[model samples]
Target: MEVAIDNSEFSYLPAQAEALGVPLPPVERLTLPLADGRTLSALRFGSEAPRVTLLHGAGLNAHTWDTTALALQQPLLAIDLAGHGDSSWRDDVDYTPRTLARDVAAAVEAWTTQPQLMVGQSLGGLTGAALAASRPDLVSEVIVIDITPGIDVTAGPAALREFYAGPTDFASRDELVDKAISLGFGGTRPETERGVFLNTRMRADGRVEWKHHFAHLAAQALAAHDPGSATAPSVLHETGWDDLAAVTAPITLVRAARGFVSEADAADFQRRVPTARLVVLDATHNVQETAPVALAGLIESATPARRI
Candidate 1:
């Protein structure tokens, strides 16, 4: 489903001051076939140009990077990670970075001939690291936002956990919007409301449910008898740091001041990935949503004049 941007009520901007005279880039919802037969859905900005690829954090879709994409004003493709957004859910429940990276690598290989600048947030960040490590040819530069393998994986955003642990289907859209606002999903009511609208779909059963599959998979994992079962892959597997270290391209780590990655963790990350440059922002976990302008500037600076 497309986002409603023409309406005044839905026109709440995150970094409006920075995007003041910039023309709104054209956005198109696209789906690409993967080698495994499942499809990867994405929001493509502009057309026929070297692009920047964006991967949103778990429980989020391509729309999460909408403001940042707009601020950048460059060709971009923001994809919905497998088991999240409009992408097909994996029955095997293998949401590991390697598994998700394969899908993204396929999409990248199919979409852009030149290596693209990759920016990923949280779970997406780990996936980006994995992709760069495994297929360095497809990515020119890597920017991981607010995620490090060193951070305690067992801990997650409390409000986000509570929000996801709640009911799946809502009777009314406003009810879901209210729940999102109460859970502190977005700062303003309009922004929160728009986020709910972008991430939900009306089922044939006449109920509104989240478009992403993370919550459902989380519930399934929680209910599973065996933690090591194929249905619930270990979320804290020790491969991310290795992947981060393997990347030879230019790397930038964007950390949120009030988010998960601590100062010590950042230092450890730099120690592990010697080529990584760290930039801390005064935001929360979702830096793309909270600080689009600054994040965009960092991205633009990290992106080279031409991809090799």
Candidate 2:
């Protein structure tokens, strides 16, 4: 289903998005074939437009961009990071930033020959950084939203329980939507956009289950599972410090003003990545959903160094 961007209420997209020709509600849906034979769901818009890849966090699929992706004139590619949304769920894979980054790299390769603009949220942001650090050749510019390399040591799985555990069996979509509002975007979402997560799944069997594996994704996010044995993955760890320094790609970080990735981590990240600039948006950990406008502007700012 394509997003209806021409509507008055939906025209509030970033100035840069006009160049990309992003549409409202967008032609968004799944787009990936995993090596394990599972096709990951990717929300795509503007195949002919300048390429922009947006990666969402754990527990969230691409639906977070109901408002943001519409603004990009470039091809907007929002992938369900492995095991989230409609992506294949592997019980044994480690599901670390390294592996998820690899998944994103492969998907990005299929969509554009030119270096693509990569924007990531939460796990997506951290994974995007690792991807740019791991494969600078493919990513033109990088936008890390609400996350930094150092990470918030104190923020743990307990903080995510409310979001990960919601009712899957409801007779009415309104009930589910209400639950999503109360849990995820509550105070952050505008009344018109309060139940935006409804876009995450396809209706089937008179019920709406999330397009993701609740347990496996939870374990993956909390680092309790390692299905793929991904050697040593990077989270906000010290060893990956070199990776941040090694990436020569122009990187812009848009962090949630209040959330997991703390002020110190942001400072440490800026200090580490030579070509990195940081922008703290007034939002939560899920900045993409809560502050899509600010996030969109930051993404525009993260254009490849040549454009800059």
Candidate 3:
């Protein structure tokens, strides 16, 4: 079905989409293999910005960046993220941000030749940071949206449990969409935004599932949040705060002002990074959806000039 962006709700469709935003690509698909042997499905908006890659959060696939990617006006690439969307997942393997970070790194290497700008949300954000630290050259800049090493991570696992405590079987795509509306966007969303939400996959079986493997992901996110974990992120004000100290590229912290990331922490993260900028939107966790105009303005202003 052709998705419509309307005023009934979610009035941020192409009607309002910038006249000069980056061009989008024709229909295409790729199922690339990851190090663990699992295949990941990804989409490319434009093949120009050999250095631009956008990563989605846990439970969400690359589709989450569709609007923002277009707004950024550079060559764009978004992945379903292994075990999420169309990508395959291993039940027995431990799913950690570090592991997913590796998944993103391999995908970036396969897709691009020059350094890349990694823009990731939540789980993807942590994974992106790890990537910047590991493959400093592969990354041109990093944008961690709505998450920080210091934010309360338990929130992720709790939300994950609520989303995947058990199977949510549905007889049709409509039924699945209803369930998704309640779980993801806090329900009561306008029909316009529903267009975007329905884009999530619906299996042939009578089940409505998110793009990611919730079972293992829930466990991994819980571990990442554990207070006892040695790698837990430090608060912005804490001493020796250097989350991305090893990262040589300029880092930009995009935040949903009203989202999971705390304001104080956002400032601290910006201060911690050597060459970084802080951009916050009057939005919920989903800034790309809530404040696309505000976010687009930020990206247009702060994002480094891209190369063809």
- Clashes per candidate, residues 3 or more apart or on different chains: 0, 23, 5
For TM-score, candidate 2 versus 3, the one ahead is 3
* TM-score against native, each model: 0.87, 0.74, 0.74
lDDT tens string, model 1, 110-135? 77778989899988899998999999
TM-score of 1: 0.87
- Candidate 1, residue 252: Cα displacement in angstroms equals 1.0
Candidate 3 to truth, TM: 0.74
In candidate 1, list every pair of residues with a backbone clash: none
lDDT of 3 by residue, 23-141 (tens): 44432345687665678777676655446676776566766665766666566677777666667765554445666667777877788787777877776777777788788878878
Model 2: residue 32 alpha-carbon error in angstroms:
2.4
Question: Sort by TM-score, best first: what order?
Answer: 1, 3, 2
Q: Residue pairs in steric clash, candidate 3? A: 84-211, 84-212, 85-211, 149-233, 170-206
Sort by lDDT, best first. 1, 2, 3
> Among all windows of ten consecutive residues in candidate 2, which has the lowest summed lDDT?
1-10
Compared with the true structure, the alpha-carbon lDDT of candidate 1 equals: 0.78
lDDT of 3: 0.61
Please give the lDDT score at residue 61 for candidate 3: 70
Error of 3 at 191 (Å): 5.0
